[model samples]
Target: MDRTLTTATTAKIADAATAGSAHAVGLAEWLTRRAARAPHKPALTCNGITWNYGELIERIERMSAVLAAGGVTPGARVGYLGLNDPMFVVVLFATARIGAICVPLNFRLSGQELAFIIGDAGVHTLVVGEEHIAVIDAVRTDLACHCFIHRGGAVPGWESADALMAGARAERSLPVAVPVRADDVAVIMYTSGTTGHPKGAMLTHGNFWANNLNEMFLWDMVSTDVTLNFAPMFHVGGLLCGSMATLLAGGHLMLQRAFDAEAVLHAVAAHRITVSFAVPAMLLFISQHAAFEAADLSSLRLIAVGGAPMPEPLLRLYGARNIPVHQGYGMTETASMITFLHPDRSSDKLGSSGTPPLMTEIKLIDASGEPVTAPGATGEICVRGANVMPGYWNRPEATQASFTPDGWFRSGDIGYRDAEGFLYVCDRIKDMVISGGENIYPAEVESVLYDHPDIAEVAVIGAPDARWGERVVAVVAPCPGKSITLEGLHAFAEGKLARYKLPKELRIVDALPRNSTGKVLKATLRVHNVATATGSP
Candidate 1:
């Protein structure tokens, strides 16, 4: 019983990992507990189907037996390269039941991009979707995935997931051999590679348990609550936090394959979903969607956002609509949200990323490791918690450099904390654009540019320049039937930002390039060889 901590206080209890010997404990256990307590309770709802606790556990058990019969073993890397699905949950629990580590691959990644992650994670058994089956087949020669379980529909070199489940037993029929430990790696979520190739963040069982416990403390969760989690299952924010967080409360998860605003709104109303989590970009899409005004989104109690920042305008819009939106902050290393914007401070603290999660200890430190005491003094955001990942998978040097000597995981984000402890992110260390010896943050510029009437979407990137080292350029998608001159945009931004911070060049387009999750893919944009001189500075 956690003899590591001598205290029995509630605060210490808040940090305690769930009672378990191993980290990679099967979802079967969690399901069994809830089923025993309330068998009829809906555990998951998706695509016009609702699965109760007992039923979900039975499916997971069948899937686990299927995987075990297919030669899956302890420590085996089972990769789920698919979008969000109820089947993903089955795969997740089934992988854990046999003591295997689940590697959920992002479907949005290109074949080459996915190949790197597959090789890096040593994923030999890939359970992909029909959409990614061709990509997997194309890159199968180089990747380690020998056995593939294809969902969605049938494809060659892939066994049907439904067929496997049909043939397998619906109970834990195999003899227990390897024990699931609380510290064993449960998931290896690849970080969103904004800068380079994605690195696997090895999240142990304690990481998830801690995250779940911290979530209960920071947010209101109950067994009666139904969560409409539209976020992709491949991401830690979705799989670990969004999905698992709902499970921890013995609540229901309404699964959607992807974030379709009208669909999500329908699900929330249809399923009576009490909670929802999404990225800032998703929130923007939902708010901007044509059916926003007509949709009944009132069933949503707490709508949490993270992954990226939303401007204050969006916050006001959500608040006006009766959905209290709280912005959360974390990385793959923290399992999900090491910090979340509290409901109370959602409106009171505008542009703030809220407080650290109950189990987390956060500090802002400079290059010298000295703490920044001032409110506006931007420093690196470092987090220490049970929720924090042990290290990167198979990269000791990268892991060692990722933390301080004392155990804080160094987040490469520049942010400041207020006296009340709310965080205000300034910029990413890697994303900071330098022009003519001047420092500029794309977020700051982007936030200001977002306020303009003509702009639909805007991305500020550092363009390669032989003279200024890197010039600031704004690539924007304008609203339909509306246009803004490059000089006019400069004139609008000039007062809000410094001269170097203002976009020296403005390029209008039909649409801005975005990642699979709708995040502006700046790296891809930087390689865009389009240059047009509008009436600019």
Candidate 2:
């Protein structure tokens, strides 16, 4: 009896030890708990398919096992080049499960650019979507990775994702139990290179969880909220704010492969999407679509806009339609949103980026590194928060330089806070155009031009000028059936802009060059050797 009692006690102690060690707070572990708690809850809905929390967890487990079997161990870099498919989410969580870092390649990048990132990140495996297979094929010779997984269909020398998942089912296998710590680097998001080669921002699992918490707090997200992800999954705004936020709140996510204004409009109504995030340009396009007048938008309660300056007219339109436009501010370094304008203050605090979310501290500093305390004093915005990335991947010097001695990350954006503690962004310090002796912020000029009825899309960039250091130029895409002339722009901006802020040159095109997140690629515009004068300024 004594021996049996001792054995029972030992078994109980072992079980207690196991229970204590079982809980993990990594980005992916939250999903596992959600699955256990709400197995029947709709988790992801995309392309006519809906997966419940339980089924989604199973798929993620299978994908994680598949990745492990393919020699992807802890700390391995896995590159993904794909559209905004639900599979991307699976791959991301799978990477997190095995403690591997996911490097989501921007499909819009050139073959050389893609090769550079792949090599820099030391990626051993690449997963390419069907549409981008040719893009990978072009750069395969330069890529160091030997393993390729294709998502849509069979490709020579590429393992089919469908087949691999099927094999996992046939084998009745489970994911290898790899310990993933909260601080483990989950993703290395490459910055969109407006100046030079992109640097990878190492976002740890803790950073992701913090961002999700911020999203939940700011958006007041609930599990019943049906969210739509129209933005590209490769971008932080789409992945973090759109899908991940919903997943964190135990809400349903509707995924789109790509952004089509009509498709987004239809999906919102069809799926009863309650919340979404988009760039200013996307919001404009969707609002202007013909279906906007007919589509049942009663379900959409909140829409967050970012990535560019939000035009006042767009805000007014949403207000008129009884939908709230919440403008947010953040970058790749912060995972997603650091500051967001509340829906109630969208009109009253027009153009303000809003206050910093909980646990995020924001301060502005001048050139001499002195803090700007006075309200309305423009300074480089700096932030420190749990959501902020640990540092640039493999770039220690850059990482060190990004933060101040006090541990705040320099945002490089020139902005100021109002008396009410609302944040208003002026412009990017690097993007400031200096013509002769005057400092001209392109956003100010762009905002003025955007107000014009004839203009559909506008980007202000500084063109090289031997005479004036740099000349203010406007690259515009006119509204349908409307033509924009330099004279018309000058007349429209005569009173609103100063002489130096006015566009010295105008180039009308079919569309403006934009990044995946709808940010106008001003660097690309500067290289266009086209110049036309409607008349001498």
Among these predictions, the greatest TM-score belongs to 2
Give the Å shift of residue 162 in candidate 2: 0.9
- Candidate 2 has its poorest 10 consecutive residues by lDDT at 1-10
lDDT of 2 at 31: 71
Q: By summed lDDT, which 10 consecutive residues of candidate 1 come out lowest? A: 1-10
Q: lDDT tens string, model 2, 1-537?
A: 011112332333234334544335576677766655566688898898888876676677778888888999889999999888878988998888788889998776667668888998999889889898987798788888968998955778889987887677512465554667667899999873333456899998888888888888888899999999988888888888767878877899999888899999889888899999887667777888988988888898899877665777777887788888788888889887768888788777888999998858799999988999899999999999888888998888889988998899998889999998899987676676655423466766777789999899988887666445467888888899998888889898875554556888888778888889998787778777544444342
Provide the overall lDDT of each model, using Cα atoms, as 2-decimal numbers.
Answer: 0.74, 0.79
- lDDT of prediction 2: 0.79
For model 2, the stretches where C-alpha displacement exceeds 4 angstroms are 1-23, 170-172, 432-537
